[model samples]
Target: MRKALRLTALAGLFMASFAQAATPIDVYRDPNCGCCKSWIKYLEANGFSVNDHVEPNMSALKQRLGVAPRLPPCHTAVIGGKFVEGHVPVAQIRELEKHPELRGIAVPGMPAGSPGMEMGQAAQAYQVIGLTQDGTDEVLASYPASSTQ
Candidate 1:
């Protein structure tokens, strides 16, 4: 009986972790951009399933996707009806997933130390900005860029 309980507990733990996992994101980026590829790899390594779309006309795509000009980045992603722009952290993406009402999230420019943009121990201060369909935005969180201690 004890062994059965232990096995059931283990199974439960495994299922819980799996259920909490983040869903894959479909990313659209410029084919020639190395930074965008790096960001995709970062997402994949951190357990995000990436669907990459390499387009020659990234600007046109961005505009069509309704990603604001002020929040342009190296890449853009859409998942569960939410748009993710720039080098946004996986954790923030997960947070956005929980809030179904949000239109999208953006990091604006590529800040040094943001995931694939890491540069030594120095990190840039950047904001994860949230947006609405009407073009309103608000700061979700301010993340410091840093890859090393």
Candidate 2:
């Protein structure tokens, strides 16, 4: 009985870990950006299944998707009905999953220390902004910038 119980607990633990892995995220980015690739790698390392699409005209894509210019970034993603921009933290993405009403999230410009943008030792200060369907935005979280500048 003891051995059976231990096996059951172990199985449960494994299942829990699997469930916590990041979900599928469709990321659209410019083909020439190195930071964008790094960001994709970050998501993959954290369990996110990414379907990456490289486009030369990211501006047109953004415009069609209703993304605000002020919140633009090196990449864009659509996951669980929320649009994600830039090197957004995996934790924030998970949090957004809980709020189904949000239209999306944006990190704006490529600030240092943001996932793939990390450089140097000092982190830059940046904000993660959430947008609604109509284009209004709200500050969701603030993170330290990349060390490189």
Candidate 3:
């Protein structure tokens, strides 16, 4: 009976940790885009459960999601009912969790060194922009181009 109780407690903790880490997200991307797949892997590693929606018409999908044309990226995601575009870092997602007032966030273009766009030792200056419901945006985070970037 003691063993059973211990197992049950372990199971409960496991489920809670999984829930806390995983933020369910539906990703929209082109089936042929390798970078997009890499980005998905980044999210999974960061504890997000991603559902891929591979479609040839990426533009249409973005349009349907009300993604601003100003912030264009190879992929987009719906998470916690908020839009997440491009290779946003896991850390930024944590920030988003804090700012429930914002609608979503995006990294305009796929900059090198950003999660999936990583190239050999090259990181470009990039900004993670936050979007409001009315389509206004602000820079939530900025990353400098660095050797470690």
In model 2, residue pairs whose N, Cα or C atoms come closer than 3 Å (at least 3 residues apart or on different chains), thus clashing, are 112-146, 113-146, 119-148, 122-147, 123-145, 124-144, 124-145, 124-146, 125-145
lDDT of 2: 0.85
Instruction: Please report the candidate that would top lDDT against the real structure.
Output: 3
lDDT of 3 by residue, 1-149 (tens): 99999999999999899878787889998878999999999988888888999888988877877778998788888877777889889888777877776788899888988999886877889999998877788889999988863
The local distance difference test score of model 3 is 0.86
Rank candidates by TM-score, best first. 3, 2, 1
Ranking by lDDT: 3, 2, 1
Candidate whose TM-score is highest: 3
Q: Rate the local accuracy (lDDT) of all candidates.
A: 0.84, 0.85, 0.86
User: What TM value does model 2 have?
Assistant: 0.80
Residue pairs of candidate 1 with colliding backbone atoms: 123-145
Write candidate 2's Cα lDDT for 42-123 as tens digits: 9998989899998889999888877888888779988876689888999889899776657888888887777898766677
User: lDDT of model 2 at residue 42?
Assistant: 96
lDDT of 3 at 89: 91
